[model samples]
Target chain A: EAEVAQSPRYKITEKSQAVAFWCDPISGHATLYWYRQILGQGPELLVQFQDESVVDDSQLPKDRFSAERLKGVDSTLKIQPAELGDSAMYLCASRPTGGLGYTFGSGTRLTVV
Target chain B: GQQVMQIPQYQHVQEGEDFTTYCNSSTTLSNIQWYKQRPGGHPVFLIQLVKSGEVKKQKRLTFQFGEAKKNSSLHITATQTTDVGTYFCAGPISGNQFYFGTGTSLTVIP
Candidate 1:
């Protein structure tokens, strides 16, 4: 089975530092998503991409977070001047067009000190 | 914004005991999906229920979609230690944007 790939399984950064996470969706998947999971809460959508265009980012904190998928294949999410409250598990998921379910990556756990 | 809520935030049962989790959506859903996440792991898709009043089972696990298409339930028969995990239910808000439930954490005592 093909799996979504994510990098930096864990990250620790200073409050004012910048951090970035990478994700590679499974081949042929056209829908990719970035979600944030707090300690005991479910994953919340941060952004959704269809091919190379963003479909929805209503919940994303535009002031400090930005994501891009230049080639419509791999994506990167960057947070500038990370804050302590930004610590959480960042999960990347992808699925083929009109697919019923998603394949999630292991996720990047971020911690800001 | 959409909300999906699960009941019994935490559950503790013996190895041989049964367990169940309920998921409710704020709005009518076209489809519902179930997922499980082990401690320190990402959520893994378990099953998807599409039609209204549908029931599907996976050996020891049973899933049911309500007739209203706004509620779902997952039942485990004779849960084992390996069943210890957090279960989440998700539904699409629009197109491919899915909203996940609060989740239910299960702890099976060996």
Candidate 2:
């Protein structure tokens, strides 16, 4: 089965350092999402992209976090000056046209020391 | 902002027993989706309910959407070791943005 590909399965960074995670969604899936999952907590939406255009990013911490899907396919999420509280799993998901279910990536686990 | 809540933050069930998780939304949802995440794993989509009062089944698992579309439930009959994980309910608040419930973590003991 096709799956979303994510890079840097695990990452450790010092506080105030910059880190980035990459995600390649399944081909032909137009909707992409970036979510943050803290330990013992549900996933929280960070950004949403529809065909290379951002549909929603209200929850994203714009001062420190940024996400982009330039080609409407693969995407990247970046955090500058990472903080300890930023340590968590970053997940990417894609939805096919007219599909109800989402296919999520394995996720990148980030640990800010 | 929309809030989704799930009951029984944690559940420990003996193998072969039944387990249920309930989900509720502060506002009516257009649709509700269920996902399972094993420890140290990403969330995997399980099912989605769109219509009010809809019911769907997948093998031993059953899902129900309330009449008001503001609540849902997931029931696992005869739970097994493989059924251990956290179950989360998610719904779109507006457009493509989705909000997830707090989640219910299940542990099946053999």
Candidate 3:
């Protein structure tokens, strides 16, 4: 089975620093999502992309967070001047057009000090 | 904004017992999906319920969607240690946006 790939399984950085995470969705998937999950809580959507265009980003904190899927295949999420509260598991998921379910990557665990 | 809530934020059950979790959405849903996440692991898709009053079973696990299409439930029979994890229900609010429930964490004790 094809799997979504994520890099840097774990990361720890100081507050006010910049951090970035990458995700490569399965081939042929047109829908990609980036989610942030606090401890003991459900995942929260931060951004969604259709092909190379952003479809929804209302929940994203544009002041400090940014995400891009330039070619519609892989994506990158960045948080500049990270805050302590930003520590969480960042998950990336992808689904085919009109597909019923999503395949999630292992996720990048972020820890801000 | 849409929200999905799950009851019994946490559940502890003895091995071999049955367990169930309920998910309720603020608005009618086009479809509902169930996912399981083990400790330190990412969410894994388990099933999807579409039609109203639809029910599906996968081995010892059963899933049901309400007639109103606003709620759903997941039941596990003869729970085992491997069943320990958090269960989440998700529904799409629009063509591109999906929301996940608060999640129900389960701990099966042997």
Q: Which 10 consecutive residues of model 1 chain A have the lowest summed lDDT?
A: A94-103
Q: Write the per-residue lDDT of candidate 2 for residues A1-113, one digit (tens) a residue.
A: 99999999999999999999999999999999999999999999999999999989989999999999998989999999899999999999999878988899999999999
- For residues B1-110, what per-residue lDDT tens digits would candidate 2 score against the true structure? 33999998999999999999999998899999999999989999999999999999999999999999999999999999999999999998776567999999999999
Q: What does candidate 3's lDDT look like per residue over B42-88, in tens digits? A: 99999999999999999999999999999999999999999999999
Q: Mark the 10 consecutive residues where model 3 chain B has the least summed lDDT.
A: B91-100
Model 3 bad stretches (over 4 Å): none
Specify the highest-DockQ model's number.
2
Look at candidate 1 and tell me the lDDT of residue A24.
99
Candidate 3 i-RMS (Å)? Answer: 0.6
Runs in model 1 lying further than 4 Å from the true structure:
none
Per-residue alpha-carbon lDDT of candidate 1 for residues B13-54, written as tens digits (9 for 90 to 100): 999999999999988999999999999999999999999999
| Model 3 pairs in collision | none
Docking class of 1: high
lDDT tens digits, residue span A87-111, model 1 = 9999999999978788999999999
The numbered model that scores best in lDDT is: 1
Candidate 3's displacement at residue B55, Å, is: 0.3
| Candidate 3 lDDT tens digits, A1-113 | 89999988999999999999999999999999999999999999999999999999989999999999988899999999899999999999999998878899999999999
RMSD (Å) per prediction: 1.0, 1.0, 1.0
Residue A12's lDDT in candidate 1: 98
